[model samples]
Target: MPRKSLPALSRRMFLVASGIAAGALALPHSVLATEPEHTAISTLAFDGESLLAGGANLVRSDDGGQSWTELPAPGPILALATHPERPGLVLAGLASGGVALSEDGGRTWESRSDGLPEGEVDAVAVASRQPDMIYAAVQGDGLWKSENAGQSWSFAMDRPWLEETEHDLLTLASVDLATGMGGIWIYAGTEAGLTRVPDCFCRWQDVQPGNAMDALVSGDAPPSEAPLPAGEAVRALASAPSAPETLYSALPSGIWTSRDGGVVWSHLVDRPASAVAVHPSDAMQVVAVLDGTLQMSRDGGATWTALAAE
Candidate 1:
């Protein structure tokens, strides 16, 4: 029998995840289109030229959005990532099923949540340059690391510095890997702000408006929608491989950018962004989701162009 189908494992998972409710939580409030609710798109990832989307289920398009096929998964997928250079390596974060890894692209999968505290995976990320390293953001849980690919996880937030953090209440909305001139860094979207972690994953910080606020105060771009609040929850985030220092962070106030890594942040636009994805090869190109609409930006998210559903 397949290891994933083991009777004990299945029974435990069913009890732990609470079945359908957990799977539904993996998705953002999806747009209720005339189309079937199961087909409503949520988030997106790119594997080569193929586009993969998830909401209530998993779907893929090899030739852009001209055609899409529903893909089988252990449960409803919440977030996904594809290896940049690897032709057949995919990782998925499930709503209530934890994380799964695939060596034959999306054709097959194996469970990889041995040490995860919670099976509700909110986001997943993998750097193509080093495929063996992967990260998973568990909802309400701080984060988990898997050094040996996605075989297992070492729960974070055990550090003393994170003791003050309410990882149980703070929902990790999104996570992305940044690599380039500055260095390799990990970005996570949270209710407070966009959080960043170093290569060692020993410590972390968030995007603060200290020095960057000076530029905004002087009217570099424009006055923000309102005064920055005491706490800002990040809706989504994306980082380009070509520009590691650059981070696009979506906050309730608007979208902001960090040029010198995530140290300083400046408001770029005052538009709501629910989700974001950077181009695999081009840092200047980015895709964002706004009110369930697809928008693309070729100028490093400085501007955007809306894309109608196909």
Candidate 2:
């Protein structure tokens, strides 16, 4: 979910049980045509043979990238994810920080973020090991979690960041233990730095060894010059299912990579991407979004495919 403008807290529960609203896919007129970069795809994923991307609205393309059809959302969606074990159970995070569930793929949606946080949604993810476990990162809030899908939620932030700064959490990435080596890894990309909690009951500590991320999460050491600048956010995060240790992050500076979990890091490129995802089976295949355009790097980062319109 794009977080340029966050709605007020009073408008938290948008239980839009009604069917798809009117003008769900209205294209802008020629007079108001904007550049492709302005409509960057905020999030991307592959659901079976279909490609789903979220930005101004949730759009789906059954025939790859040839064309796309808009799926109605309560507001500009910032986050989207599918249940690993349950097909057709698509989860969407709205700009208002509300969560919606789609039982029939993307055809219909229903708000289920009743007990969740109140703000814009930055990212949403489901654990493959524990299929029922769902997590959301609220833009102006900390973290939220739900055990029974999105029907209900609770604040999952374990530290002071939960209530101290509403805008501390920016994005999140969860790696299921069943698919990975073992043990769950929930990475919370925050303004202070990246924090990691092994499981739902573990404590959160800065993933970056000696970076400012540590200071931001621990409040022990003075700000240190880490790869991430002071107060720079970890905007988007993704991990391949085959190799969960190989993590990717879209940071304020640029794309950052971690080969052995989040231990060591190096700046990949200065071209900032809003979100990134690696092919579940192929490590070489990667996709990222710059501005509103989508691009692919099939052969590692040596070359990139052309930017495609969403």
| lDDT leader | 2
Clash pairs, model 2 backbone: 1-77, 1-78, 1-79, 2-78, 39-292, 40-291, 40-292, 41-292, 140-166
Relative to the unseen true structure, what is the C-alpha lDDT of residue 200 in candidate 2, on a scale of 0 to 100? 44
Task: Give stretches of model 2 more than 4 Å off.
Answer: 1-38, 158-167, 177-182, 208-231, 307-310
Q: Pick the candidate with the highest TM-score.
A: 2
Q: Which pairs in model 1 have colliding backbones?
A: none
True-vs-predicted CA distance for residue 106, candidate 2, Å: 1.7
Candidate 1's C-alpha runs over 4 A off are 1-40, 127-129, 159-165, 168-183, 207-230, 264-269
- lDDT assessment of candidate 2: 0.61
TM-score of each: 0.69, 0.74
Error of 1 at 72 (Å): 1.9
Q: How many clashing residue pairs appear in each of the predictions shown?
A: 0, 9
TM-score of candidate 2 relative to the true fold = 0.74
What is the C-alpha lDDT profile of model 1 across 34-60, one tens digit per residue?
A: 111221444566676666665555555
Candidate 2 residue 172 C-alpha distance from true site, Å: 0.9
